[model samples]
Target: MSGPAPIHVVVVGSGLAGYGVLRELRKLAPDATLTLVTADDGHFYSKPALSTALAKGKHADTLVTTPAAKMAAQLRLDLRAGRGVEALDAGERVLLTTGGPIPYDKLVLAMGADPVKVTIEGEGATRARPVNNLDDYRAFRENLPNGARVLVMGGGLVGSEFANDLSGAGYKAVVVDMLSHPLAQLVPQQVGDAIRDALAAQGVEWHLGRKVVSLDRADAATIATLDDGTRIEADAVLSAVGLRPHIWLARDAGLETARGIKVDATGRTSDPHIYAIGDCAEYPRGLAAYVTPIMAAARAIAPSALGTPTEIRFPPLSVQVKTTAYPVVLLPAPIGVKGGWRKVSDGSDGLKYLFEDETGRTRGYVLTGSLCEERMDMDRSLSAAEAEREAA
Candidate 1:
């Protein structure tokens, strides 16, 4: 006589977060039924590599490390590619997709995030593109002519990386942002200045403290109007403003959402059987949108999804900025925490900055250029300080 039916775990999205869950779950329960559903082709590629591929002379197709079929065979997962979930019925434990309804014992949401689009007025406004995915990168490359002058909007991590990559690929890159310096949100002013100067030496133009007001087509080129009445002509524009979590599905399904899908320490949503991770999941402080946090969440949530409950405790994770012109590693202080930044060292090679609170507790740190090699050591120091705070 057959015993209880095999538990089927359905994971939405095939990106790093979803794949991480699948990998960990398999190790815990090798015979567990697993299915992966994604809107795009389920090929495996490093999402971070999209920003630097151009500099390395790599195409979108070549970026994929493993094909979908091969990954499915190796992982023993039921793969559903190029199919989006139309709706979700949490009460019935079913996902409504174009193919059909998929019944599952547990559901995992790792739908990722969407690029934030900036609205501008003009005929050439539609020409501005964002390279958030492989398909977007392919289209951007196809539309860009040789030696094209590309206008990059925003000065955050993604924007800085793209600007450097474009310049390295023999294309002219001009970055425009409303902030005074590049990566103002992530790094100190001095660090940002160093990066701006280094990238400038490599032929990248910086148009800081100005916003793109509009984009108008003039003859064969696109004219970008800045807030300060400055005009620049370019062949293409790329916007790397930021990313917003894709939480519409979860919110519409009656799940709680803040900046992202609200989840507990165990990655469990409002519904006990539903869990989320990656950029789409919001923990207590905020969304941990980086790779390390996602992997940590996946490891903590896998056992819980498989019936053995576990909780996640995220340690401090350093963000490694992918700007080839000037490498940077930053561990930002917690939001709203009272602290002040102090310059530790400034030399020809690079600079180092640290953040500490009133009680002499080290909260965060940033290292640039050759000094970035001290990342692991600084991370350990930060961890020790955190341990002391907790012990007290």
Candidate 2:
């Protein structure tokens, strides 16, 4: 009798999450057939590096580590670049793409998220650019002239990083956010204040507790009107508000979705044959958008996608804030947990803060500047604390 055909795995997306899954799957089943379909050029590039590329003097073109053709050949994948999956038929196990319908034994949705755009009125509102992907970064770089004044909206991680990069690149960066301080959601007020001071010293102007209501065209520049009637002139505007997961694909296909495509610990969707990972997948905890989570999910889901069931267990992960002026490491406290940040240490070099719950359990920690060295120890403590809570 002839041997059964090799199981085909179809991965939709070419981002770090999608490729990470493919890498893991290849290791588990070298002979299995794999295909990658992406809407973009399918080049391998670090999404995190985009925020710091300008400061490092790296061109947009150089950001792509590997082109699609080379990646496909290296990984033995059937790469389909620049094609979108218009519809997904879960019952039939078929994906309707720009090329044609493709069937697979297992399907992975790593579609990723889209940049959240804020609504602004006036003439130059549409001119506000968001550098979420490589293509967007290229266009932003091309339009940015020497000594351009950039108006950055949002004071979160991406916005702060871009502001610092812009300042380092010899551009005037004015950051506007409705929040009282930068990284309000990640760090305490004191920590945010310290970072704000450091970035300000590097020529990053802050417009805290304010929102850009409108954008109008000036002589050759753009005028941004704040909520408080303050007008600022800039050559360009960059929005780093946030990201909304691309869930229409999974939702339209009748898969359960909330903030993102709902998947179990094994990355399996409501339909067992289909799976989701990366920024697009929402686990029990929430959306794991960072690289570490993506890698962890990939390792766990690879076996399950290949017929061997495996569930992922996430460890305490630290989020590193990329502001060279004052490096920050944070382990965010669990949502809805009763806790308050207590100062552990504060010195000229840096500061440290610990989150303690009502039961006197250390839930999370934050370290900045030279204090970042204690990340490993702090992470261990956080894990131990969590374990203690679970046992109780």
| CA lDDT of each prediction against the hidden true structure | 0.90, 0.92
lDDT of 1 by residue, 1-392 (tens): 98877789999999899999999988888888999999999998999999899989899899999999998998899999989899999999999998899999999999999989889988899878899888999999888899999999999989999999999999999999999899888778999998899899999999999999999998878999998899999999999998999999999999999889999989999999899999999987678888888898989899999887888767787898888889899987766778788999999768999888787677788889889999988888777876787799
For model 2, what is the error of residue 382's alpha carbon versus the real structure, in angstroms, after optimal superposition? 2.4
Runs off by more than 4 Å, candidate 1? none
Please give the lDDT score at residue 92 for candidate 1.
93
TM-score of 2: 0.97
lDDT tens per residue, model 2, 119-213: 99998998888899999999999889999999999999999999989999999999999999999988899999988999999999999999999
* Pairs in steric clash, model 1: none
- What's the TM for model 1? 0.96
What lDDT score goes with residue 317 in model 1?
78
